[model samples]
Target chain A: MSMIGDIARLPAGVPETAARPQVSVATAEDYVALLKPRVMSLVVFTALVGLMAAPGPIHPVLAFTALLCIAVGAGASGALNMWYDADIDALMTRTAGRPIPRRRIAPGEALGFGITLAGFAVVVLGLLVSWLAAALLAFTILFYVVVYTMWLKRSTPQNIVIGGAAGALPPVIGWAAVTGSITLEPLLLFLIIFVWTPPHFWALALIRTEDYARAGVPMLPVVAGAAATRRQIMIYSLLLIPVGASPWLFGYAGLVYGLTALVAGALMLAFAWRVWTRTEGKAATTAARQMFIYSILYLFGLFAVLLVESIAGRVVG
Target chain B: MDNKPDPTELTEEQKRSRRSRSIAIAMVLGVLVVLFYFVTLVKGPAVLNRPL
Candidate 1:
C-alpha cells in the first residue's frame, strides 16, 4: 500500500521535460495512491458481508485473512490501472495531479507494485482460505487490470457496464470463502452491487465530462453526453431498488434490512431524478455530486442493516 | 510522462528534492511496518476470537 508520493520517488525510468514538460519524476507515495484505497475499502466491506452471510462456517482467523487478501487484490488492480492510465490521467483535470502524470511515480514502478501485490494476495488467500476464493480474487485482479483497464476502457463507452463484473465479484468471493462455492445468496449480493455501479459511477461521470474528454477517456458522459448519461443513471437507479430488496424477500434478511433498502432506494431515485431534471450548470454538478456521495451512503447503509439483521437472527434463532 | 529529464538541468535541485521525498517515503513505510506488526503480530490473533 505505498502512497502516490512513494512511487514519485522512483530514481530512474521517468521521463520529464520531454512531452508536455514541467514534469518531474514520480516519488514513492504516488505509487501507493495508484491503488485507490477508498475504492478498495468499499470492496472489502462488500466482500466481508458476503463472507459473513454465507451458510457455512469459517475459522475467524481465515475469514480475516481472506478479507485482507481480497482488499489487497483490489488494490493491486487499482495500481495496475494507474500504471496504464498514467498518460491519460495527466490530461484530465480530475486526474491530472495523480502520481504518474504529476511526475510522482514512474509507470514501471506502479506496474511492479501492482503485480507484486496481486501475486501476494492470491498466495495468501490460497493458503488461508479455499483455493476458490483465491482463484476468484485472481480473476478480479486480472479482469480489472486487463479486460477493463487495457481493453474495455479504450474500446467502448459500455466499458463500465461490462467491466463492472470485477467489482461485483467481491461479495461472491466472500461467500465462497465460507461456503467454498458460489450460491444464490452471494449472487444476490453481487447483483445488488453490479446494478448499482452504473448509476453510481455515471453520476460522477456526469460531473467529470470535461475531465474524461480532456483525457481521451471514453467515459459515458464523454461518449453519450450529459443528457443521455443522466437518463441511463436514472434507469440504473430504478433497477437497483428491486435488486437491493431481493435479499429480504427471499428470506436472507429481516424487516430491518427491507425497510433500509426501501428508504435508501427511494432517496437514490430522488437524487437520480433530480439529476435528470438538472441542466448543464453548477446545479447539475451539485446534483451529480450529491448522488455520488449519497449512493455510497445508501450502499453502506443497506449492507449495515443486513449485518444487524443477521446478528439479530443469530441471537433470536 | 516525459521520457527524458532535461540533461541541461543541474543535478542540485533534483537531488535535493529527491533526498527529501525519499526520506519522507521511507519514514512512512517504516511507520506502516511498525503498525502492521504491532497491530497484527501482537494483537491480531487475540482479536479474532475476541467477539462483539
Candidate 2:
C-alpha cells in the first residue's frame, strides 16, 4: 500500500473510538480497541524502562509475566474509560462512532469487560509479582475511570493535568514490581510522563476543540480558546526541557541521552512557539499535530537511549 | 377532605409509584451486576495468591 493510504487508514484515535461503538460488532479488533492498544504501546515501553532500570535482577519468565500484567492493567484502564465515557461520547462527533455509541457493543458489556480485566490484571500482578505493583495498578485504573472519567472530566478545565497522574504511574509500578520499593529514578520517569501529558493532550484538544465543546467536556482548548491553549502548550513545552533532562541530570542515563534530550526538547519548544504564533488554520493545526507526534518519538528516544547506554557499558566491560 | 375509594381502582398515583419502584430496582440490579463482575470475574480469589 502507498504511504498515504497507510496514514489514512490509521484510527482517528480515542475520541473517535467512542463515536461508533456499535460499529465495532464484537470483532477481535473491537476487543483490542477496548484495550486501547495504542495507549498500551507507550505504557509498555515506559514500564519496560522501569523494569530494566531496577537495581537487581528479575527472572526472565517472571519478568515477562510482570510486563504482561502491566500491559493487561493498562488495557483494563482503556476499556473502563471507554465504558464510562460512552454517554457524552455519543454527543461528540469525534466520539459518536465508537462501539458503544454506535450500538456495536452494549454499554453494560463494556463495563463488564473492563471491570473483569481490571480485577484480573490486579490480582495476577499482585499474586505473580508484588502487592505494591498490584496496588498501584488498581489505583491507576480507579484514577482513570472514576477520578478522571466520572468526576473530573466535565467538572474542570484542569482535568487532563490531574488525570495525567494515573498515566504517569505505570513505569513506577513496573519498577516496584521488581524491587517492591519506590525510588527517585522511577519518580523521574513518572515526572517525564506527567510533564509530557498536557501538551500532548492539548494538541489534540486544539484539533478537536469544537468536539469537546459540543460534548461539554471542558478540555483546555474548549474552555480557554485557541490562543490561551497555544500559550499553555508553549508553556508546557518550555518546562519539558528541564523535566526531560532529569534522567541525565540525576545520572540514570549517559551523555548521549542528555544531548539528545537537549536537542529534542529545544525542537519541541520551537514547534510549540510556532504553534503559539500561528493564526488558527491548517498551519496551526499542523504544528500542533507535529508536536503531538514528536512527543511520542521524544519519549521513545529517551527510554531507548537508556537501554542502549546500559547495554554498551556491559559490552565494553 | 373526605374520600371514598373504589374497591379496585387503578389510580395515577399508584401507577406512577410502581414505575418509579421498577426503575429503582433496575438501577440497583445494574450496579450489582457491575460490582459482581469486578469482584468475581476480574479479581477472582484464585489469582490473588501465589501459584501452587
Candidate 3:
C-alpha cells in the first residue's frame, strides 16, 4: 500500500498570497475559527467530566483556570494545525473555507498566535494548577502539532490511530490538575477515548475518502481501501465496547454508567456493523455518515453519564 | 512575507473588521496581563521565602 509520505510543499493549491500578498486582515470570527471551537467544546466537556469525576475537592477559581488553560491549549494546537495544513486545507472541500485557506488570516500570524497561546496556556496551568498537569498539556500540544500534524498525518495510515493519544490526554490532564496525581480511574477514561477514536474517525474517513485522496492524506479508506477500513472500524468497535465499560467494572462508577456504556457501545457496534456489511455506494456512504454522527453522540452520552452519576453520588451520599 | 503586492486589497469593510479584531486582541491580551498579576498575588512569595 502506498502511504501519503511527507511533502516539502503541498502538491497543489498553494494560496495566491504566497506570491503576491493580499492585504486581507482577519476578523474576530476568523480568529475564533482558527481555534476550531466545535472540537474544543468536546475537549472542554470531557475535561470537565474528568475534573468532576476525580475524588477530591478543588477551588472553583482554580478549576476554572485549569479548564481555561486546557481549552486554550487545545485551541493552540488547532491553530497550529491550520497554519501547517493551509495548502491541504485549500485543496479539500471540507476545509476550503477555513480562515487560512479563505485567506482571512496570514499563515505567519496563525503560527504566532498558536505559539503564543501554547506558551501562555502551559505557563498559566503550571502556575495555577500542578506542574504535572501543565507538563501533560505541553505534551498534548506538542504531540498534536509535531508528532501528529507535522509527522504522522501525512506519513502513514496509522496517523489518527497514534495521534488519538493527544485527544485522549485531556481527561487525564484534568484529573491531574485537581489531584496533582495520576490513578487508574482517569487512565481508564483515557483508554475509552483512545479506543473510540479509530472507529469514530474511520467512519468519516470512509465518507471522505475522495477528499483525503485529493488532499494526498493517507487516511485509512484512501490507503487501505474501504473494506479494510470497515473491518478496522468493526475491530475497534469491539475493542471500544470492553474499554468503555472498564470504569464501571473497576468500581469507579455505578450501574447507570455501566448500563449507559453497554447500550451506547452496542449502538456504536450496530452503526459500524452497517458500515461493514454494506459494501455498495450510497448505502455504505449513509452507514458511514450515520456512524460518524452517532459516534459524537455516543462519546458525549458516555461522558455525560459519568458526569451525572458522579454528581448524583456526591449529592446522595 | 510576500514582497509583491496584489491587485486586490482590503475593502473598507475588511479594514474595519481588521481594526475591530486588532482591538479585540489587544483587550484580550490586557485581560490576560491582569489575570497573570492576580495569579501571582494569589501564589504569593511564600514559596520563594521557603528554606531550600
CA displacement after TM-score superposition, residue A168 of candidate 1 (Å):
1.0
Q: What is the lDDT of residue A271 in candidate 1?
A: 98
Best by TM-score: 3
- lDDT by residue for model 1 (B1-52), tens: 9875544453565555567668876885685466445445544565344221
Q: Which ranges of candidate 3 are over 4 A from the true structure?
A: A1-23, B1-11, B33-52
Clashes of 2: 19
Interface RMSD of each: 9.8, 20.0, 8.0
lDDT of 2 by residue, A6-69 (tens): 3335465634323321222254445666788889988988888888777776665556667777
lDDT of 1 at B24: 70
lDDT of 2: 0.79
Residue-wise C-alpha lDDT for candidate 3, range A1-317, written one tens digit per residue: 11123222434676644423234467888998999999999999999999889888876767888899999999999999999999999999889999999978889889999999999999888877778999999999999999999999999999999999999999999999888899999999999999999998999889889999999999999998999999999999988887999999999999999999999999899998999999898998999999999999999999999999977876776
Q: DockQ score for model 2, please?
A: 0.02
The runs of at least 3 residues in candidate 2 whose Cα sits more than 4 Å from the true structure, single-residue gaps closed, are A1-25, A312-317, B1-52
Q: After superposition, how far is residue A75 of candidate 2 from its true place, in Å?
A: 1.1
Better of 1 and 3 by lDDT: 3
The candidate, 2 or 3, that scores higher on TM-score is: 3
DockQ of each two-chain model: 0.10, 0.02, 0.29
State what share of the real interface contacts each candidate retains. Answer: 0.07, 0.02, 0.39
